[model samples]
Target chain A: MSKQKAVLSEEQIKTRRGRSVALAVTLGVLVAMFYVITIVKLGPGIMDRPL
Target chain B: MTMLEQTQGLHEDATDLGGRGSVSDYIALLKPRVMSLVVFTAAVGLVMAPGNQHPILSFISILCIAIGGGASGALNMWWDADIDAVMSRTKKRPIPAGKITRQEAFAFGMVLSFGSVLTLGLVANWVAAGLLAFTIFFYVVIYTMWLKRSTPQNIVIGGAAGALPPMVGWAAVTGDVTLVSIALFMITFTWTPPHFWALALVKNGDYQAAGVPMLPVVAGETATRHQIVLYSLLLLPVGMAPYFLGFASVFYGVGSAVLGLVFLGYAIRVWRVREGDAAKKTAMSLFKFSLFYLMLIFAGLLAENMIGLV
Candidate 1:
């Protein structure tokens, strides 16, 4: 059903490809950053091994 | 169709905010079977801990553990999306199959990770919450991103995070660590290689194709099987530790002995066969039995605690 939709021009295709790639890369970076910050913040508390 | 038409389709997908995909797709991304084992083992740890948590707090604590486990799965799926797309078994996962956007998965994982950790700290104790947070980070960043591609020992080290649930449960109750809880952690730690290597043996090609650096991919099948036997033997002694240490009763002792023996028998058969139909059959059988072995050992702990018939 969705496949029956009208197609776009060459310039539109190029722009769309660029946008999705950008979105994916942005998400990847954000998630990685979130974990890194969380770890750095929580490291002292979590990694405190009893001497 | 022109290149323009293809690009437009892409834009439509990107902009289609109203088109929420199937709920089943998101559930598939959680890797429910893996989550189930995490929940069960963590629960056993909580239940068998030396002290008791208030019922409401205990419920919240376990809920956090489950969510934390799911969060780890989500992040793992997110990072391994490329390889997941290539492998047949995992190709249908949410991100790989395009059932859910990568952005959505990342968001889901982050929210759950933060919520579970914060809630655990408030409802249980900071120690347990802290451990849960570290487990999520280690699995997602250290193991999934780094060791997985770099070395064959990925699972060996990564398995630590997997093994910590019970310790977290124990910590939730007592607000501190103990020898007993660490021993529980060690049991799962030792069991992981044999448990995973068996699957790696069966799915060697998948790892090879994905360049996963799995033990069976880097080490030969013979070596992997031998290691499985070694870990199985070591686990036998470790499995019986609770009984010997007076942490559990004779029922647990009997159950551990039987389960460990069966696990050893399969591992030995896998080691001896060396190749062909017989080897594959043994490897797969060992893989299936390994799950039962883990569950039974923990179940025995719960039963002994409940019955009080030491």
Candidate 2:
């Protein structure tokens, strides 16, 4: 037997899209924040360390 | 099926399939107004701390503190949805208004709480993270779940959670709690009762209907008014502690004194006016003035520190 898919209405689609965008923006900001913090914490000698 | 029946079925199915809330609804769950006060106070604390901190780290610390504060608000809303539904002021909140489920709020709160605390620990220090975790737990478990429904002294104890952000911010910088930070904590702690009790006086009926046991509901309006006066009096010296402790300049000292006096004047009006619209107006005036009083007090500290007047 095949299963049917649920179709979303316009309002539902808008809400889902808004939430997706918000989540994406929030995650992107978090990533950027972490990167900046890492660079700040490590200081100018960050890349000078031995492998 | 008839045309009307077919349309109704489609409508129902659409509603059921649709997402329950928008991004603004989720933001509403965070109590952004309360979060703003948290950010301001925490930023003051971070700036007032003794050590020199990187600007980027300080910004991250304030952001984490704000997110933690917002998480606590979401958790509080989850626990208080029932009472929130009954209260006129809170009936339109996300959970009570059916824009979000309690389980979803709980999950959102938990995620933000953990994420914020973990990030602060990694970027700042564990002391700040530990305080943030404790603050979330205190507000959610101790205040919302336990004290709020149980006693008239609910906000009195719960105020500690609201008062902890400055200490958390200070800890983020110094990695230790100190006397100056404790002074900031004391000012907010003492200010909470009068600030909240003023509103509680006006919203006594809402608390009574919601069965929340606010001071006005449990101990009567006159008693609550007296408590407001008492707390306002206590706020005077507590607000000036930074100046007395030699961390703030004489200007901050004088400003805090003047603000505290004005706060007391408002509280006196609340105590003197005892009936009808005048009474409510007086109480509301005190409530509004209380917010101004706190902002000025913290702003004075921030200004003093920034101008190197401390």
Candidate 3:
């Protein structure tokens, strides 16, 4: 069987890329902020917590 | 335009408002303005709680509360889309505007609600999670679905959902609500009637068109204005309960007292003046001041607690 090529409209591709980037950035920020706050709040013994 | 006709334009875009949904549309569905108040009050609740929480947990708790608030707003928008479409004020909302499908908004709200509650449960305690869940149910199912269209006393009773955020925040930090948190809830609870009624007085037609039984629509402006004065008078003492209970400093008490009088003054203006543009203008004034009234009162509490002035 012939393989079907992936086809997407330019606008669709752009939207997909934009949404992916936004979601990735949001998740990254949340994770980073959580860790940063954990360090700030927990202080030098941050690693000692059950986290 | 008639209510049905007003919705025709949004309906024509069956493809939906502005072509397609974007991140911003989702944000709008969450009612960012409302969520800001929720976040601020919740933060104030967390701060005023008796003990210190780990800062990370505190951040997570606030985030979860914000998510819960946003989720509830989305659900309200989802269910209220039909009424919303008919109203000029809400005609451009995600579902009504035709940008997001009702099904999409409902699913989005469901996911966020469950995610927020589960995250809060995992990261903090179940008490706060339970409160958050109940808040979503109260606002979405009880307030929006049951009370909004059926009764003139809708905002009076439904106001409980909006007033619960501080208690949620207090629970998040302390794992239990105390007398002080109850006092905080009371402040917002009492404040809601006048705040919403002021807007209802201004936009009575929208509610009438939507078949929503807002007090101003059902009771006539005169009666609704009377109710505003009554609630404002009630707020006089409830606003100062924090100070009287020794949770706030005398300075904050004086500030709250001053704010209460100013709020009462605006409500009294709406009560006594009813013959001209001044009537709507006075309602608008009370509406505007009530927004600042809550922000300033809550901010004062936050400052007093953070500074240990109480």
Scored by DockQ, the top model is 2
Fraction of true contacts retained by every candidate, in order, equals 0.00, 0.85, 0.10
Please provide, for model 2 over B185-304, each residue's C-alpha lDDT reduced to its tens digit, 9 standing for 90 to 100.
999999999999999999998888788899999899999989999999999999999989999999988999999999999999999999999999999999999999999999889988
Per-residue lDDT of candidate 3, residues B262-299 (tens digit):
99999998999897788899999999999999999999
- Pick the winner on lDDT between candidates 1 and 2: 2
TM-score for each predicted model, relative to the true structure: 0.81, 0.94, 0.89
What do the candidate models score in CA lDDT, each in turn?
0.82, 0.91, 0.89
Worst 10 residues of 3 chain B by lDDT: B10-19
Enumerate clash totals for all models, in the order shown. Answer: 5, 0, 3
TM-score of chain B of each: 0.93, 0.94, 0.95
Greater DockQ among 2 and 3 belongs to 2
Question: What value does the lDDT take at residue B280 in candidate 2?
Answer: 98
Ranking by DockQ: 2, 3, 1
Scored on chain A only, each candidate's TM-score is 0.74, 0.85, 0.68
| Predictions' DockQ, in order | 0.03, 0.80, 0.23
Model 1 per-residue lDDT tens digits across residues B191-238: 999999998988898888777899888878978988999999999989
lDDT of candidate 1 over A1-51, digit per residue (tens): 466875666755664566566569757965774565455445667577576
